[model samples]
Target: MADAPTDITLHQKSKILEVVFEDGATYNLPLEYLRVYSPSAEVRGHGGPMQLVTGKKDVGVEQIDPVGNYAIQLHFDDGHNTGIFSWDTLRELGENYEANWADYLKRLEDAGATREKLWH
Candidate 1:
């Protein structure tokens, strides 16, 4: 696993989360993507079925709280604050962004939903 984030900046205007890892890899992750891909059990179920979060076109992160040296909890504008995103998870999300995004889009299509990505 790569090192944890050395820095994290929230761009409220652009609704982006900029994370710089200790391994020198940085990622500009969308707020919506983070919301949808939250590691919370509410979003990701205990076992089989997972939830399909939707209608988060303009969701923004309200706050970010650090967890015990392993992860960070994101407080989203929609009142979601359970996801504990670890360094490894964040890095994987950055590395596999393209595929994950594509899969998200495909899931939306499969569910007859809209992309609903906020454009600024």
Candidate 2:
């Protein structure tokens, strides 16, 4: 069980979701990061290796819908609304942001992919 967020703000201009936990820990999670690392079964398979999501560098968060008192569904501009980020998952994502992001980057590199797609 994780402490609920004391505050949650969507910085529309910056495309970042700022969350402050009860323990005085705050995280400015980027929309792209959240979109790529979505906890949805689409991104994370039911089992085995998770899928790699790409071409979401300019994606925007459309809205946040509360799911009872346990999680929140992030509606993305890409029309993705399957992931429900629970309090504990959010805390883990925030706490392990650096490591997770590094791993994602390395995976992208290994796959010969770029954060953003090539422009025509």
Candidate 3:
């Protein structure tokens, strides 16, 4: 079964997405990191090869709008915001944060990429 988020909040100033689960676990996800890992075809691609997004260290969320009751539409400062982040997806992200983040860091290290700001 998939975990569900109990509450969700966006901290614009800090560029962080906070999610609270029913188990009382809270996760703080950075906007830049989210943007880089967007599920949209523009970022993730469709059927063919996956495109790796680079040089997104300074990217931030320009706006976040509700997409019905299922998801949220995030607008990025870099003009890329087709990703509809669903509650289920957010919960999954929260659950797999450590593994996903570690993999991201490893990819960055392998590509010689560094984030401009630190995410906590």
Q: Find the candidate with the highest TM-score and give its number.
A: 2
Arrange candidates, best TM-score first. Answer: 2, 1, 3
Which wins on lDDT, candidate 1 or candidate 3? 1
TM-scores for all candidates? 0.91, 0.94, 0.80
Candidate 3 versus the native: TM-score? Answer: 0.80
On residues 1-120, what C-alpha lDDT tens digit does candidate 3 reach at each position? 335467778888887889887888888988877887787888778876545676677787878888777777889988988998887777777678789778878887887877654456
Report the lDDT tens digits of candidate 2 across residue range 1-120. Answer: 787898889898899989899889999998888988899999998897888887788889889999888788999998999999998888888889999999989999999898795678
Model 1 regions lying over 4 Å from their true place: 117-120
Kindly report which residue pairs in candidate 2 clash with one another.
none
lDDT score of residue 43 within candidate 1: 82
Best by lDDT: 2
Cα lDDT of candidate 1 equals 0.88
Q: Write the per-residue lDDT of candidate 1 for residues 14-84, one digit (tens) a residue.
A: 99999998778999999999998998999888886777888787899989999988888999998999899
Task: Report lDDT (CA) for all predictions.
Answer: 0.88, 0.89, 0.77
